[model samples]
Every structure is written in C-alpha cells, then in structure tokens.
Target: MSSKSDTIQVGMTNTFACSYLPEQQEQLLVLQENTLNVELFEQLLTLGFRRSGETLYKPHCPNCRACQPIRIPVKHFSASRRQKRTLKHNRDLSWSIVNTTSDEHYQLYQQYIEQRHHDGPMYPPSRAQYDNFIQCAWHQPQLIEVRDNKELIGVAITDVLPNSLSAIYSFFSPTQEKRSMGSLMILIQCRIAKLMGKDFLYLGYQIDASRKMNYKKAYQPYEILTANGWQQSE
Candidate 1:
C-alpha cells in the first residue's frame, strides 16, 4: 500500500484582505497532506511554514512580504531586560503540559477573545471556532497550562515536534494583563523547549507593521527565513 506520506500536495489561496496590514492583500500556500507527522512538519517549519489547527501554511502574498517566519535558537537565546522581568514576575505561577483541553480552557479563550480581540475576526468566539482554531484533527497538541493558586489564568496552544515546539496560540484572563501573561506563556514555551533539548522554538511569523503582532523579534538570537535561507538576527 502506498503511504499517506508518499505524495504530498499543496495549494494556494486567493488574495484576500490582509489581517495585519491595512493597505495590502494576503495570500497563503497551504499544505494538503492527508496525514502529517512531526518529522514532515519540522521540515516544513525550517522552510517558514506555520500551523493553524491542522492546516499548515506560509504567506505567499504577491505584493508584500511582511510575514517573516521566525524561530528562536533555544540554546543561543538570551532574554531581554523586559522579558527577564516577565519571567521573574511570573515565577509565582505554575505551569504544566497536557495533551487535552477542557471547559476551563474554552472559558478563558472566550473571555480573552471577547475582551481583547472583539475588533478582529475571532471576536465572537464560539465552541466551534475554539475547536477549529486550537484543536487539531490530525494530532493532539501539547497545551501549556498556567495557574495561580487554583485559578486557571492562561493556556498556550503548542505543537511539540521532534526537534522544536511551535507556538500556535495563547490566551489568558484579560484581567491578568498586568502579569503580561501573553509573554509569560511564550517564555514558558521556550523553557520547555530548552528542557526537552530542542534546537528551536518556532514562533510563527514576525510581522513588523502590526503593533500587536510584532513582538516575536524581542526574543533575541532568533532566525528569520529569508531568500538566502535562515539568517540569524542578533
């Protein structure tokens, strides 16, 4: 029998409104594999691809190249002053990795989207949306759960691959914004990747124009996929 990995297919999407850039359109090159594995996905990650649930895609915009795929070399990474402060501040919190999701996860996600992303496409978060956006159909992702005493404050949707961990999405209690839970969750992912002896932590894309989405570069010693291949930025 031919293996599902024998012949992989890929497709592209029509140009649409760019979610991050107001004046540009966006396009994507998507992988259409019937079955995906960590080894294959890690190869794709090195080529600047990212996952949204079960689908893997990379920006193929004709007129713009704002989406730069970025990843941190966990061994070479140095926390910035602000990121160090974030780590120190979040020391009181506890984190654990799990392969399942719960109502608590959905509740925090709903609250986060309703309060923080109401102006965006995922404003009216629903169970269906939550399932499609965060839960994968092919593989179960590792969810990093953070808590304060007994309260579930944050959840980071992460994909654990053979050589790296991909940051899919993260949501936290909007009331806990002061804790910088978003950044804290990312730091946690990095720590986990380091402990696992992974070489990189794929951080999706680094969009320079979007104030809300451009923070990925803050993780120093990250590499961005370029026409010349993965180039290190110090």
Candidate 2:
C-alpha cells in the first residue's frame, strides 16, 4: 500500500468478476489504511467510495460506466405518493438504531439471504461471512432494526459519517413481500439522516441496467456522481 497521508493509504485490486452485472469484470481503487476515522471516510464517500467491512473501495472499471454513485439531498427530498403509502402501511413497525450486531440480527440476515438472494454471490450465508462483511475494525456501523410488534423483521446496516449516512445493506423477511421492507428501510435511513442534520444519504452505486438496482432512481432529486461532478437527475 502507498501512504497518501498520515491517516490514509491507497491501493488497487486486480480485476474481478462484477457482482452486480453478468459476465462483466470489475476493478476497484481501494483505501487500505488502518484506524480510519469517520471524517476521512465521509470524504471518501463523496468521491464514490463505499465500505465493505473495513475496506473502502470505488469502482474503477475500464470499460463500463454503468455503476453511478448516488446520494439524496435530504432537505430537498419529497416522498412520492406511493412512498408515503409505504410509510403509512408499515407504521406499526418500530425501529431502533444501535452500534453493535447481535445473534438475532445474524439469524434474520441468514434467512433473508437464503430466501431472497440464493442466486446471488451472498447465498448460503454463514456467521463468519456476516462478521467479515458487516463489521469493520475502524468503523462501527449502526444497525437499524425494525420489528413488527415483538417480531424482528428487517435490518439496515448503515455507516454513520460526519455529514451523511451511508446505507450499506438491508435485508428483510422474504415472506413479507407486500410490506416492501427493503424500501421501508431506505426511507427510514432518509428520515434518520434528515433528523441528524445530515445533508445527504449516500446510497452506494445506482446501476440503471439492473432491475434490482434501477429502483434507486425512485428516490427523486438524487444526484449521480459523473465526470462533470454530481449531476441531479431529471
């Protein structure tokens, strides 16, 4: 690794198969520093970097421009009528944010992955994988746990930064498809970010070609990081 500063070092990983698109390869510019603080990580996010466990990476694909980093300008975000309905429908569920992971969270994650993501890379979930993927040595991500009365239903693993909150990953009960817990989790993050006086909610990469990912556009007034800089969606 090459030191860029006292608190940041940089490196690049060899090209690997793209996880979000089929038959496409991906390369990443990575931050390989120890004890990364929130302030530095927040700066990285603005530059299109995301955290996977303790590592921070930005897509460096040579041929493709499909992965666009996106964020919501919280103060300007207004919920669509459909999104408003989603909030009203699931108003019975309560959410609490915490800084640690638990056995219950892992169990829900395993069930969600096995049921909803069996065809993806994260299939056949295990505790070791969960720990390595969700927990980081330098950053303690917040877990937004959603419960229906007394039953655990969803979790949003989030990285809280100096001026924004990054929605790292979210999973929910596969059986409750009608509840749209995935969308609900994101809405909750937006609400939390607004409440915390944050200006933006960093939502990782928005790949318009992928059916699973294209929905990110639904969060209107969002900005996509481009060569010209952060461009607002029409």
lDDT of 1 at 228: 97
Q: Name the runs in model 1 displaced over 4 angstroms.
A: 1-5
Q: What is the C-alpha local distance difference test score of candidate 1?
A: 0.89
> In each prediction, how many residue pairs overlap at the backbone (N, C-alpha, C within less than 3 A)?
0, 0
Per-residue lDDT of candidate 2, residues 204-234 (tens digit): 9999888888888898889999998999988
Q: For candidate 2, what's the RMSD?
A: 1.9
Poorest lDDT segment (10 consecutive residues) of candidate 1: 1-10
- Which residue pairs come into collision in candidate 1? none
lDDT of 1 by residue, 1-234 (tens): 288648778899999998889799999999857578778888989999888778889999999998989999998888899999998988899999988999999999999999999988888999998988776667789889999998999999998988999999999999998999988988899989999999999998999999988999889899999999999995
All candidates' lDDT scores?
Answer: 0.89, 0.90
